[model samples]
Target: MSRRRLPELTHHGDRLPAQEERERVDMLDGRVGVEERACRGLLDGRLGASVFLVRSPGVVDGRGELVACTPEACSRWVRAAAEYVIVVNDVSAELEAAHRRAASVPWWRYVAAQRAFRDWKTIARRYEEVTREAAEAYEPVAREIGRALAEMVEIAAQERARQQDETRRHRSVLAARAFWGWSEVTEAGRRAVYVFRHDVPRDDAPEGAAPEESPHVDLRGLRRAIVDLDLPDVRWDGAALAETERELAGIGFGRWWRDLFHEDFRTFTAPPPARGSSSGRSSPSGGTATGGTGGFSGGFSCGGGF
Candidate 1:
């Protein structure tokens, strides 16, 4: 929907400029009132510590109406734009760093990072953009955000599936490769030993600096890369993988759901529709699905599958 510019209010003899008025509007629009509650979920892991706001269901009304927004409306919109400034000294470098940190973390956390990144890119971004527009006096189109949350959960499920597949699938690793601080004497040493290492991509590494390859002194994998000086059938369980199918399936999205949605909302009442996907053997609908795939329960955790 288009932004609607609320008429600027005058104080004494001074008149606020149109741009300043827009700025004023931005701050008040979509802003949580001091009385309203808020909860934050820091993007877990190295996804670059980004922050977003999740709120309770009151500021927004039943007909998509917004209730008493702010009493200090005059100053709020003026500072709104200034409030949301994301500055990373280097974009690519930061993203790469976050990705590196993200590597080898819990499968569930990696999944959370994926979702958080997308949220930062989309939903969270949208909220900010909408606030900006609202400050400009443009009204956001109202829709059931509950459904949108469902879609996010669905994408999470898909990501989990992908991770599972990647774990069991074969990955290519160069043979006779130089491992950090040491060269693999695979041919001379034990053939059964599995080695793990962190290899940063050339492009991500600093200019002209040979990419650092940090090899784990501990054997983390078990494969026959036994041929010395030859590229034996080397592969990557690709590191950062879930140790077992049980761990993979054990991760739950319940907390994520509850955190994003309040207890009263139906979406928060049960595991996402794919309960079995993350919660092992349970159905996504939770309990017995006596009706069409519905979200309702006595008291369910949001740990659906984050």
Candidate 2:
């Protein structure tokens, strides 16, 4: 038999209702906040699960009977896991970039050294601020994604139970036909089988049957890191800001301000060729802080192509 194509999924379009069609279009009207656009874009990338449904053996249940599942179920599992990983990496990258910006300036050492300085007192302050922002932006969305994943797991379990029941019911009807001395190839046996197809709830698994694996394992593991993130307790304090301003005015801030801008430009711009060097600026020692994504380097292999 020819395989059937499952329904196609759009990134963000399917999320809106018929009444909100205009609202989706209006998002490009230049009035949407940058933060909102960024969050939406991060959550709605070019990603989807498999498009075909095929049956295959899944994990063994508590009764040791290997459960069967639709291919889409496993595909969606991997997709949800991948999305969870991506959200965590995005938040980590944002926090790291903020730290780099603050630390790259020459005067950062001087400012960071003063523990009593409430304005930019601790280097931890930068991390705290960035983490809070990330949490506020992503916590709710991450929870929604986790909820979708748990629901998918439950659906798969329910479908497995239904299929198992159907198989048992068919077998029982065949047994009955045999006991009645009716050959399956005969007209009477075929009629019995047809009648049994419409039978409802005759072969449900008995009480204390095999239990399926817990869906919460994925939610509690590394896949659901965002849901378990330790959000910072930082908040805005006007008094601290006033103190920062007063401190800035007390020092020769004008010179330091110009140096800060210059340092930023130098740090970002490509270097000019070194004089009299044959091999053009022999790549800086220790490889010049390449800003690689080390956070996502391991343990992110999705079982299916996510």
Which has the greatest lDDT?
1
Q: Could you tell me which 10 consecutive residues in candidate 1 have the lowest summed lDDT?
A: 1-10
lDDT of 2 by residue, 113-213 (tens): 23223322243355345534545554554444445445656878999999878755643343233111001111212111000011112132222222132
Local distance difference test scores for all models:
0.29, 0.28
Looking at candidate 2, what is the lDDT of residue 125?
54
Give TM per candidate. Answer: 0.16, 0.24
Question: TM-score of model 2 relative to the true fold?
Answer: 0.24
lDDT of 2 at 231: 19
What stretches of model 1 exceed 4 Å from their correct place?
Answer: 1-143, 171-306
